[model samples]
Target: MANHDTETTEKLEKFGKRLKELRKAKGYENYEQFAFKNNISRSQYGRYEKGQDIRFSSICKVLKALDVTFEEFFKGFD
Candidate 1:
């Protein structure tokens, strides 16, 4: 259970890093600006970037905002 928890945390962190990278690549220097533009809650988006857990539907919304497909988002992730 401990190992699983650790793995989950690591994955979440990686996801957050990837999200930030994509946001920068998309020309959004600030997460708040991105969130506001995309109609996402700025606070929640900040939490997500800080490696918090997010729902699948919310992730889908984020992906749409980022203009990335699931495959593209998860491309280099294990």
Candidate 2:
């Protein structure tokens, strides 16, 4: 079970890093800027970008802001 937790954490962190890079590529400066535009808090956005095990609902909100699906967002990681 511990190993499973680690695997999930790794994936979450990878997702976070990927999200950060994509946002940067789109010309967003930082989590604060993205969050502001998306109407979320900077701290919350930072948590998602920094790996806090993002919830499905949060992902939905992010998808709306970034205009990308999870498949497309994660394809680069593959």
Candidate 3:
């Protein structure tokens, strides 16, 4: 159980890193600006970037806002 928890934490952190990477690539240096522009909850998006859990539908919205397909967003993740 401990190992599983660790693995989950690692995955979440990686996901957050990927999100930040994409956001920066899209020319938004500030997460707040990105969230505000996309009509997402800025605090929630900040939590997401800090590796907090997120809902599937919310992630889909984020992906759409980032102009990335599911496949593209998950490309390098395992």
Using TM-score as the measure, the top candidate is: 1
For all predicted structures, in order, the TM-scores are 0.93, 0.85, 0.92
User: Would you give me the overall lDDT of model 1?
Assistant: 0.93
lDDT of 1 by residue, 9-40 (tens): 99989999999999999999999999999999
Ranking by lDDT: 1, 3, 2
Model 2: per-residue lDDT, tens digit, 1-78?
A: 133477788888898898898789889988898899889878988988987767789888887788888788878664
lDDT of 1 at 31: 100
Question: In model 3, how many backbone clashes occur?
Answer: 0
What is candidate 1's TM-score against the reference? 0.93
Candidate with the larger TM-score of 1 and 3 = 1
Q: What is the lDDT of residue 24 in candidate 2?
A: 91
lDDT of each: 0.93, 0.82, 0.91
RMSD of 2: 2.8
lDDT by residue for model 3 (1-78), tens: 133487898988898899999999999999999999999999999988887898899999999999999999899788
Instruction: List runs of model 3 lying over 4 Å from the truth.
Output: 1-4
